[model samples]
Target: MAKKPEDKVLAQNKKANHDYFIEETIEAGIVLQGTEIKSIRNAKVQLKDAFIRIRNNEAWISNMHISPYEQGNRFNHDPLRSRKLLLHKKQISTLIGETKRDGYTIVPLKMYLKNGFAKVLIGVGKGKKEYDKRDVLKKKEAKRDMDRAFKERNQ
Candidate 1:
């Protein structure tokens, strides 16, 4: 069987996993300018500190940094700008309803190129308390220890 081509990931917000308890995730298209797409194709994008917001039934991503293309000249796009996210009306409505709940927000988990189009994987997340963050770290440490022990035993 032929191997399937994998989607190219441009960037990921690793902190999103640490700061939020993600309940659900969905892929959405992003609107990009000409220079923006050129920059994305070169893998010059950052998802750190980026978040999604719903306003007037439209979803927008804020704080996303797509570096300007080196050769873009005067047409270079802004590095940090709010970008529109494309989703179905139903999805937008659902996201709006969910975001209205206390402590619930939308976060972008990853950015990737699918079939030559830039897409974002967004998640519905709730803020985590400090204690919760510590607990997660503890669990990760335990898991790592177990994995190491198991590997030694198998060896």
Candidate 2:
């Protein structure tokens, strides 16, 4: 199957995949201030340490950093404020259920612009143990070796 083209990706949490097994991903709209949107469009956002949290029956993205717009002046928004995420009620309920499980949490996988709006791809992930990470690395190395051998044979 052909992979779909990605939207204009603004930021990604590379460590999310390394530290957790992402079970499911959901795209949700973000509520951004004027300067925040400008900053996002400039690709000055960071999702490295961002995570999703459910509070008062609403989903919020905490610790996501969107740098202040260069010319924003006094109207610039905070870089580290918790931003609200827009999701359907049923989706929020499901996420709440999933996160209640031990070691399971909501993580922001990527942030992107879709149709001039900022959208966040959040995932339900379970934390990986040290052994699990090592096993994954070993499997990846084996796959790389196999692919290299196949290329040599074809050559």
Candidate 3:
């Protein structure tokens, strides 16, 4: 038996889960400039505030911040440029249909290097209300307390 190497996660949008209810996620390849890849290899990427947009039957990621490579100098790509996402026509259509719904949006969940190429996990999320956020937090706290009680009983 051989162990498989895991994909190296570069950046994650932690707030995505708290801000919206993720319905479905899709993995898509990203078009990156030369320097962008180098910056990602060093984990100099931020998925916070990043989102996906579908236009002209194409998927694009906007607001993803990939820091300038230290050695790139003039060759460094724009840190906040919109990058194309490589998804099939079927997937793009699915995203388009999903986003047409009220309060539904496409958000970037995670970015990582898979097989030496940069990929992003995008999700169709529906916005949550203020009360929804509070409910989630309370459930999390209750789970933590329950776990603590269970541990004490075992001890």
Per-residue lDDT of candidate 1, residues 1-155 (tens digit):
11222598889889999999988888899998879998888988999989898878899999999999999999998889899999999889888888889999999988888889988999999999999999999999999999999999999
Q: Which stretches of candidate 1 lie over 4 Å from their true place?
A: 1-6
lDDT tens digits, residue span 1-155, model 2: 11222787888899999999988888899998879988899999999989888999999999999999999999998899999999999999999999999999999988888778888888899999999999999999999999999999999
Model 3 residue 66 lDDT score:
95
lDDT of 3 by residue, 1-155 (tens): 11222587889899999999998888888998878899999999999999888889999999999999999989999899999999989889988999999999999888888889888888899999999999999999999999999999999
Model 2 residue pairs with clashes: none
Clashes of 1: 0
Clashing pairs in 3: none
